[model samples]
Target: MVIGIAVIVLVLLGLTFCVIPVVAHRFGEAAERAAETEAIAQGARGGVLAEHRVRFKESAAEMAIPFGIAAVLFALAACDAAGVGAARVLTWIVAAVLLVIGGFVTSGQLRAAQWTAAAFRRSSDPVVRGLDTEAIVSAAAREFPAWLRPLQVVRFLLTTVGLLVVIVALITPSAAAHFR
Candidate 1:
């Protein structure tokens, strides 16, 4: 039962700390790349665009640490769930990895707003210069990734439901016993 509780907690932690950041980062990268490509195709080429792309890539890589930690936790949880070989040592190793590389990534495509604003500020193009910097940044953030919309909904639902389950299992005597 203790193992059951541990698994639940691990899953919760993994989802909260690891999976969400990586997934969100990935979604953001795709959007940035698409935006970059579209801009290029539209004959928009300049130092600003170049810098924006560079920042976009850097931001994407920053989330790797959390993703790695989440992966390890999830794997340990799976091993625990399976009732297989013990992962006592493995858990420590994963923890170390998480500690070493647990750096955070950008929150979402919203980070792209900064890059976009920077690009606009640096651009020589009069049209780009004329655009409101704040508006562009705000618009960039507002343009939510269409593909991630459904996934976002699902993630929210699962997180809420999982939290409820964890709460109930921890509080109710009978339910708590099951996870003992």
Candidate 2:
């Protein structure tokens, strides 16, 4: 039961943090490029563009819920696994921390996109003033840093390693006995 719960939670986290973003970015790349080009042509400042690419200003509530749930679940799993040994506890702790960090990173990226899109929509530039704000916002939301890809790779690898360790520990009879 513990193993089942852990696997399910990890799978959900993987989908939420890893798979969906890559798929979204791939499908939305062209549109984002077009929007950036248009925004540049309309006299959007380079500094603003750079800020839009990196800065994220938004409420924390968006990140708190999902990450909080994951944290709680992992904590429960760790407590249940405690009698097994220190290794499971350590692995769960590491995985929970990494997952929380990943969630924050994702939340920031999303907020940056929203901020950029809103900034563009409010601009007085001729092209921006005339074009559909919805389209502009959609494109801006799709924009992400080049570094995100590599970061995602590292995050996925480490999280997977931690998850596997937990799963293995859970499967062993001696380890599983404690949870029961």
Candidate 3:
């Protein structure tokens, strides 16, 4: 029973660490880029300031859906009837790699945004110059921030945890159904 329960947990963790992050990254990118573009169209300064308001909100919203669903699944798995195994160690390794990449991505985002903004500012056209420095030009482009380091670490941790979850799922020596 313990093994089965663990397996279920492992699967849920897999979705959380793997699937959820991908979806969040994708949609969040869209939301941010779009919001920035909209901000520029309306006229704003302090590019950072312009993007902070609406784009931030949109990015969070875009990311929340998948993680929220994964959370629910985790809860469900926790109440399952059996124990799980420890074979999921492999998946964690993969998750760690993904997270490392994610870290680079986060840092890259900030650099890219800075360069893009600088380029826009240097353009010879006055209209482009007048377009609001703080506002984003598109939905897909924005600064990622240095905080990605922690996120990368967290991702690595989660991958390790996910492996443990799979182990639990496979070992299932006991059952906690009806209530844990």
TM-score of each: 0.41, 0.43, 0.30
Write candidate 2's Cα lDDT for 53-134 as tens digits: 4222223444455456456555555455454355456546756665567545555444544555576567666554454444
**Which has the higher TM-score value, candidate number 1 or candidate number 3?**
1
lDDT for each residue of candidate 3 in 81-158, tens digit (9 for 90 to 100): 322222233333433553465345444443544645565576565554555444453444343433433554444444
lDDT of 1 by residue, 1-180 (tens): 655765776676677655455555655555455555545544556444555443332255677765665777788778756644445345445544443333212223334455566666676786554545444443333344554445444444434444344344434555333434
State the lDDT at 60 in candidate 2: 42
Q: Is candidate 1 or candidate 2 better by TM-score?
A: 2
Query: How high is the lDDT of residue 111 in model 2?
Result: 53
Best by lDDT: 2
Alpha-carbon lDDT of model 1: 0.51
Top-TM-score candidate index: 2
Residue pairs of candidate 2 with colliding backbone atoms: none
Candidate lDDT (C-alpha), each = 0.51, 0.51, 0.46
Query: How many residue pairs clash in each candidate at the backbone level?
Result: 3, 0, 39
- After superposition, which runs of candidate 2 have C-alpha atoms over 4 Å from their true positions? 37-42, 45-87, 114-135, 140-180
List where candidate 3 sits over 4 angstroms from the true fold: 1-61, 64-87, 109-180
